[model samples]
Target: MYHYTDFDRQFIHQRAAQYRDQLERNLRGELKDDEFRPLRLQNGWYVQRYAPMLRVAVPYGELSSRQLRVLSKIARDYDQPSAAVYAHASATQAELGTPHLPVGHGHFSTRQNVQFNWIPLDKSADVMDLLAKVDLHGIQTSGNCIRNITSDALAGIAPDEDIDPRPYAEIMRQWSTLHPEFAHLPRKFKIAITGAEEDRAATAWHDVGLHLRRNALGQIGFKVLVGGGMGRTPVIASTLREFLPWDQILNYLEAVVRVYNRFGRRDNLYKARIKILVKAEGQRFVDEVEAEFAQIVAHDGGQHTIPQAELARVSKHFLPPALVQPAQAATTNIAFEFTDKEAADYQRWLHQNVHAHKNPALRAVTLSFKRLGFAPGDATADQLCAAADLADRFSAGEVRVTHEQNLLLPWVQATDLPALWLAARSLGVAKANIGLLTDMITCPGGDFCALANARSIPLAAGIAERYQDLDELFDIGPVDLHISGCMNSCGHHHTGHIGVLGVDKDGREWYQVSLGGSDGSSLSGEAVPGKVIGPSFAASEVTDVVEALLDTYRAQRLAGEPFIASVRRLGLAPFKQAANAVRHETRDGGQVLHVHLSTVDAATD
Candidate 1:
């Protein structure tokens, strides 16, 4: 993990002081809501459905044990103490003339983001001061700027990855942070980097996705994807440049951002993303702009190539920890006996959570969030503290955050698996579903987010509850059920095997179902929904629909067919028919509408 330097410390402290004064002015009524909105956004504070929400940037999703402890402390002291209790109950009670809802403010771990809800804006500067003292800051968490650059969280530890992408991601972070050229872009931009062969980072749906690989000549290079984004107009990025050498990466990226900033629409906030620009102007125009910018930068003596001294400086910060001899051999613990049921549960967790590291004796263990009857990506203060303790004891004080919104201990010894799992279970972090269907990637939807049209976390929990039988889910094979509350696609619905997108139709929340979309090296573009299922059922009914869809896929699939493959082969008709049948039969007096199959046979036809 990268530690903050003295310069970083001073910069954050100064920024905090400035924000304190702004807060005072706003409280004094000198600044109206409209006037204070930009300032609050820049400081990562938003007036959400509750009190206030503060999104903290976990750059590249890496956190030290100390940082995790700081977050835990913040959750306990400043935010809501309980996992699901509301912070501004008094205010809500006063406004509504009734009792407040019992809901807790918890931490939400996104693919490459962490958000803390129910913050007090007036006291936020004090919180910022505490964070700065711990060498943590929230500088670019929001605003119309380049957001936190995300990379594969299992970068160096994943067995199938080509290289560690954190170093490059950090380099990009420093260059893009407060860059004057892009600070005034039409809308927020996101960048993702992936080193793994499997697309865990959802790179295909980012504004810029950098797939890192070594060339045949033994030189580092990147496959650049541009114009990939999710919103009202979802478009899977096209390969803009294949095999861009290491030295030319930054210059090329600069060209891309510059083109979007210059030509991307600003008249309509809804259509301001780079995807809209790519669609309206076509790839040829985007290519021309890139070429023009590249030529100009090249004429200036290639100023954007990472300087040798800077590269060396940043590389030293990311050096792997000193290698340690394993305390015990991998096979020595194979036949070890355990009497306690918790111990046996720990053993089962080890089988699912642990992964092989580059070092033969060491393993990378995942902490899954897919426990039955809990919302994915949520952690309480005590759980966070417990995770920090486990990291310190078993993983050399380092913790990783995954793109699936799970935590990772990247350097656990194979012999320590049982002990680590025991500690994890105590903290509610031990779940035996890493890549399984229940280990879904989700977002905070209508429950908290003001922009969300429907509730996503509840929907995810409902789906997990329906598939509570681990044996049944395992037999079904790998299937991603991603739900996004809105078109922003925060949950990455476009890439799931069974994608559910929430929408608002005539002021009522409904879901649109899509199938056969994938996030991988060989990308599948967004699949349009076969039907718009009206919102009329209780929470349990939603899960029933998912169950029907899964059963339909199982019945229709051929041997060795994955969920995505089956959906692609049979189209969305069969799944739609099955889901409607289940809805009608399971719930009496419920109507099942026949969804039209417009392009069902297009793949074969």
Candidate 2:
């Protein structure tokens, strides 16, 4: 909701102009492929498997109606022809009250950004121009620098939130954007912040995670966690600083990254992440960071302090809207009526997609992009526009993108729930499965990404199709089934209750399974790294394997036990047995060798 100042707008346009020149040069053959690769990547352009992919950053996952319209326009006018079957403009244009243009739709990613898969290199500059029109850009979205900072999707509105993390996130954004020292690092760094009771932002798995909590005196601050990441080496971040005063956040962050930049490995690209550094040094890493913070504070007489005016400036932009009525009073007073079908459908959605808001009169609704048959996070241009229109009508013209690859209408009145659900259903986004198995987090695997060792979308589809029955999913209960095409962990498989990672074994596509992983939300221990169940499964058996695991959970779980809790209690032994039973089916009247349980090789591509 933070509008750009004149200085911010001017700075973004200038950067766009610079990138446009670089793109023009590259296209004219003045720059060779190798020479232009870094330039293009810095601007978020990648030559994917079938076509070019451009990722556009959505800061803190927040979008205004105007920004959403701009995204729809880009999808209409510029997306390549092959993926533009539903790229009609009249419907979206009508909703946006703008002119109809022919283009393609965009895919939202788990990182809370939009990616256009079929963009042409020639149109890169044009895309940049379009994004700049809405005060958005792709800078820092790619490269070995800080990527977009993520927070809880329901950040400001969550009922149990101690403080809104956006102002601090924005402040960090201002400090980290194009910071000269960190422009190029040994590996890309990521940061996440969460102010809610639950770790909705997956703070435990980030390079830097700021968990805000109130002290005994009711002053808000952060519980800083560092070195947690997933890749070849998956590690939960250790507590770097237990309770960092809110005012010194930037200063503390500066010290942490500074230490990393100075000592982080640069020889091996695979082990260059801060996580590796933390692992190697252990307690010594924490000591070094604390020492650095002291030095910084001592120098220049505590000069890195955040100004109260600056905090106020960012905080004003995130002020909650006035509530229409108290939620309890409204629910009690409303004369509600519903048809049988409507009541049943609405009830399912209300239970799955709606979340409590701090403002009792308002509820946050998740508009799921993970409908059956579509890619997990993709939304057609019309769907995007329809969401924008619905947000304008019901949520005061604001929408949020969740780190789980879903869209959230953050401030809908309780009274408008039925109308919003109906409209969302028409757009094919009302799937009534927010935390269920069908609501998976997946990456664009071998189908599009060149780095992928196996296709992930098909695997995700197969799994979703297997569990399409809502009754079965509800029975299964809350489970995080995350799949990644490779060890890059773009899909965050390392944090799922049921984790699946694609691999290439002897030039054949296979998938490895892990269980008991979580996204850092538990009454007990959370963010527990998953253990590999057994050997990799063939593409054909992926669904069968998932079914076997779920079936085992259904049979073994205690009453009302969640999938994660079941996994923790039962351990990997039961799931491993189920997977092994399914993996050794006789083929062509021949007995196949059963895969033995072993540690997953992180080095596998």
Model 2: lDDT to the true structure? 0.82
Candidate 1 deviant stretches above 4 angstroms = 81-105, 323-333, 339-348, 521-540, 586-605
Q: Which ten residues in a row have the lowest lDDT in candidate 1?
A: 596-605
Please give the clash total of every predicted structure, in order.
5, 3
lDDT of 1: 0.72
Q: What is the TM-score of each candidate against the true structure?
A: 0.89, 0.92
**How does model 1 score by TM-score?**
0.89
lDDT of 2 by residue, 1-605 (tens): 88899999999899889988888888889988878878778777777654677889888899998899889888877786443423432343244232223237688787788888777778889889989989998888788888899999999988878889999999898889999989888789999998988888888898999999889988878999999999889998989888989989988998999999999998987889999999899999999999989988898455667988889988999987664856462341233577787777788899999888887778899998887668888887888888899988999899999988999999888888878887888889988999899889999866667677776787787788778888888898888899998788888888888899988775557789998887887532578778899888877787888899999999999998888888888888988999988888722232212111222212211
> How far in Å is the alpha carbon of 462 misplaced in model 1?
2.3
Per the 3 Å backbone cut-off, how many clashing residue pairs does candidate 2 have?
Answer: 3
Please write out the lDDT profile of model 1 over residues 411-432, one tens digit for every residue.
7877677777667777777867
